[model samples]
Target: MFLLYITALIIVIFLLETVVIDLFIVRGVKPDFILIITVYSGLFLNKTTAETIGFAFGLIQDALSFKQMGINSLSKFLIGYSIGSLRENILSENVIVQCLFTFIASCMNGIIYILILKGLFYSEIEVLDFFKDLLIQSLYNTFLAPIIFFMLNKVHFNNVREFRGRKEEARTD
Candidate 1:
């Protein structure tokens, strides 16, 4: 099943994330490959599938980091839903569209993470520094999105929706 492949990807990426973080750190941040895949799922897959992809990626991150549970999952789930819902209204295949949404989603992910930390744990994070980090990571994610998206195009899950789609013209006959 396609889901099996996705699971494999999640595991491999998780490993790479942990193993190569220090080697790939730029300005103390590595490219958010998980976020890139989440964004891609939203752009190219059905809504429920997108949400699942996002939730899975985030849950893995949360579990590995040992932070507050569900924080990452909640953020990524919302991002996936928001982006996936827009697939019908926007040009999902356009590189520009992909880059723009990835940037927005990345910023939103940071905001959600920051807000949860600040509100739940009373963590002190300066707004300026948070914004700087958010911008850098958002741009980092955005920069890598198109390249990754292109590779994922080979999979093209849009045509492989899990649920049945709208009825064909035969229904009108």
Candidate 2:
């Protein structure tokens, strides 16, 4: 049931990102909804689950966009794994922490993608322009993270263990 929900949600986000999000673009930059979803999965789901979703959705996005295959997949896979690993040490419930994680993940994804593109294809993308776009996209993703987090929280997944169990345990002391 949880897997079904996540798969459906990813499809919906992918559709929205490819077909709808461009309408709301600002300064020629649009929020990456799929990226946000990957971050959310990393923060809330198990590492393996999150990385799997990242790779799958990244492939879907690549297919839809006609870009170099596997670039987005590799970037998102790393982002999901890296951020998901931090779940053991950080307070995932904090909005500020969520925002920061999204920002950092977005920046890392951009850097990794650019590096791969440059290294593999020798694409002559201007460094400053890429940085400018990266900054804008990071800020845009950060702004959307809180809202995405709130919405995701409402959709309970049985596979994920609630942190409330720890609080309940402490209360008995």
Candidate 3:
């Protein structure tokens, strides 16, 4: 049941990010819902689970996109793994911090992805254009991250019992 809910959430976020928001509302800037989900999942979920979600979502994205396989998967895997490791160390439950991390991670992911693509394909994209798009997309993702995070947070809670359980744990510890 948990897996089903997460899968459905991923599908909805993917569609909303790529189809509804990117295609219709903001044609120029494409928000990275995958990155947001990966970061959110990593922050709240266990390492293996977070990485798995990231890998699965990345695979879905790669299958949907025309680009080569494994690129998205690898990037997302790294992002999820790294952030999950950080979460294990930090004890933060703040929404603002999560959004900030998502924003920074999205920016880093975009830059790293661009570099990886260039290295792999030897394609020389314009530097100015890359920065321009990166900035715009990062801002866009930052703006959208809170909404996605809130929705995913609810999924994580699952029910009032789960929420209460977490609150109890936090208070106890």
| lDDT per residue (tens digit) for residues 34-140 in model 2 | 78988988888778978998888888777776567998888888988998888767778789999999999899989988898899889999989989988998999
Worst-scoring 10-residue span by lDDT in model 1: 161-170
Cand. 3 TM to true fold: 0.84
Model 1 CA deviation exceeding 4 Å by range: 157-173
Selected candidate, larger TM-score, 1 vs 3:
1
Q: Highest lDDT: give the candidate number.
A: 2
- What 10-residue stretch in candidate 2 is worst by lDDT? 156-165
User: Could you tell me the lDDT of residue 39 within candidate 3?
Assistant: 84
* Model 3 per-residue lDDT tens digits across residues 128-147: 89888888877778788787
lDDT of 2: 0.83
Q: Best by TM-score, which number?
A: 2
**What C-alpha lDDT do the candidate models reach, one value each?**
0.81, 0.83, 0.77
Off by over 4 Å in 3: 21-27, 158-173
Better of 1 and 2 by TM-score: 2
* Pairs clashing within candidate 1: none
